[model samples]
Target: MSAILESADIDRALKRISHEIIERNHGLESVVLLGIPTRGAFLATRLAQILKSLGNEVPVGTLDITMHRDDLRLRPPRPLLSTLLPPGGIEGKHVVLVDDVLFSGRTIRAALDALGELGRPKTVQLAVLVDRGHRELPIRADYVGKNLPTSSNESVKVSLLEVDGHDSVEITGAR
Candidate 1:
């Protein structure tokens, strides 16, 4: 495996992304962040910290898409994580879906389905740490930390400090 992003690099990318999000929205007003469970939640918290530093107090939530995935029957049933939203919920708010990596776009699709059931947001944006192209769906991330053109055989792994005890991204060769 080859290390593609170190801790500092990931931080820098997230900082940049936070700024972009703030800039695009013209401010943090009426904005909410929902992270796809696991690493995405970590990233959302990190981004929230950066946004706080920027003087924008935005709400962050966790979205668990386990039941919304297309291949649900392909695997055995497992425990589902909690899907927590802010106090007011996503009603007419600008919701930003955050994730560690964007690969097949299936996860984001599942997230979209999951989001729809919660509440109808004014707009839904996607933010990903890495955008490794090989899209099975037409989904795309609005803000990408690093656009690493990787082969379909290779796998990109993102390790976050919140869960993995470290923040780094590595590319592992095909099995």
Candidate 2:
């Protein structure tokens, strides 16, 4: 595997993304962060910590789209994870869906479907650590940490300390 982002690079990208979210939203008063399970949840928690440092207490939650995925029948079904939300729910609040990487956009679509059942948010936006463009769907992220041009055969791997025991990102396959 070839390294694409180092720990420091990941930290910087997240810092920038956090600032952009606050700037675009004008503040974090109505912002709610929901991380797509696995690495996304770790990133969301990191973002929440950064926002907290800025005196804004952001609510971070996890959203598992395993069941909402359209390819459920194509592959073996895995155990479903829990979908946790803040106490107040997302109604009338701006929700940001966080993920480690944006590949085909299918995951984001599944996430949207999952979110719909929870509650209606005033608006829903997407944030990803890496945007290796190869979108099969029309969806796009509102906030992207890094827009890395890539190919269809390549794969992007994100490693987080909370889940992966380290913080880094790598691209594998033909370059």
Candidate 3:
């Protein structure tokens, strides 16, 4: 375990995110939540629950952009990718894209491509738990839980309760 965010702190962070999202949009109507693969999916689910509790009938789903990633060959081959297209798709809908961390913004780029194949969305806003500040693309999240300053040699690991049995973020040095 590295010295980083604790489980309780993460829970609080997510709760803050949920609140901010609702506040920024001024109520979730005709809203849709779409997530990147892995942790993004978990975050989206939680946000959906929060919206539902607030009486917002927002739609939620997951997106897998494994093949669409720009670093496809740079990283290990990721088979068994999931390309889930929403039931009604995103045509003219307000879609909120969720991801665990915002790094080079390449992942969001790939997600946009994958989203394009499904349908056109009226608006697509990004929501991330952490923004580590070193973007390579022209993208910035509309909603961010935390702005964590980090070095290029560092790595960020976000653990969620739904899968990791804990909610926290770990920053580790590249070894």
Candidate 4:
């Protein structure tokens, strides 16, 4: 496996993404960040902390899209994660869906369905740590840390300090 992003690299990318988000939204007013479960949740929390330090306290929450996935029938039973929304809910707020990686785009699709059931938001955007670029759906990320062009045979692994005890992004598989 080859390491593409080290700890410092990950940190820098996230910070840049945070700044872009602030610039695009004209500040974090009425902005709500909902992280897709697993690594996405941790990334969202970190982003919230970064945004808070930057002077705006944005609400961060987790969105479990296990039930709304399109390939549910293909996989075995999976445990459902908790769907936590910040106070005031998602109604009329700009919801940003954060995830670790954006490959197939199905996860984001499921997230949209899950979000629809919760409440109507002013707008919905997507943010991903890595975009490997093998989109099965038309979805795309609004905020991306890094765009790593990858082949279908290769795999990108993102290790975050929150879960993996370190930070790094590695790519493995036949080149």
Poorest lDDT segment (10 consecutive residues) of candidate 3: 80-89
Please list the residue runs of candidate 4 whose C-alpha ends up more than 4 Å from where it truly belongs after superposition.
none
Residue-level lDDT of model 1, residues 52-104, one tens digit each, is 99889999999999989899898899689868998979999999999999999
Error of 3 at 16 (Å): 2.3
Candidate 2 ranges with C-alpha deviation above 4 Å:
none
Clashing residue pairs in candidate 4 (N, C-alpha, C atoms within 3 angstroms): none
- The residue pairs that clash in candidate 2, if any, are none
TM-score of each: 0.98, 0.97, 0.91, 0.98
| Total backbone clashes of candidate 3, pairs 3 or more residues apart or in separate chains | 0
Q: Give the per-residue lDDT of model 3 (tens digit) for 1-175.
A: 3747787666677778777778877787667899887899888888888777767767789988886887778878878455565677789988899999999999999999988888889889999989999999999999887898999989998988888887789898865
Instruction: In angstroms, give how far residue 125 of model 1 lies from its true place.
Output: 0.2
Q: Over 4 Å off in model 3, which ranges?
A: none
Q: At residue 134, what lDDT does model 1 achieve?
A: 98
Clashes of 4: 0
Taking all chains together, the TM-score of candidate 4 against the true structure is 0.98
Across residues 1-175, which tens digit of lDDT does each residue of candidate 2 receive? 8888999998889889899999989988789999988889889999999888888899999999998999989988789886899887899999999999999999999999999998899999999999999899999999998999988888888888887898889988875
Model 1: residues >4 Å from true position, as ranges?
none
Better of 1 and 2 by TM-score: 1
lDDT of 2 at 47: 92
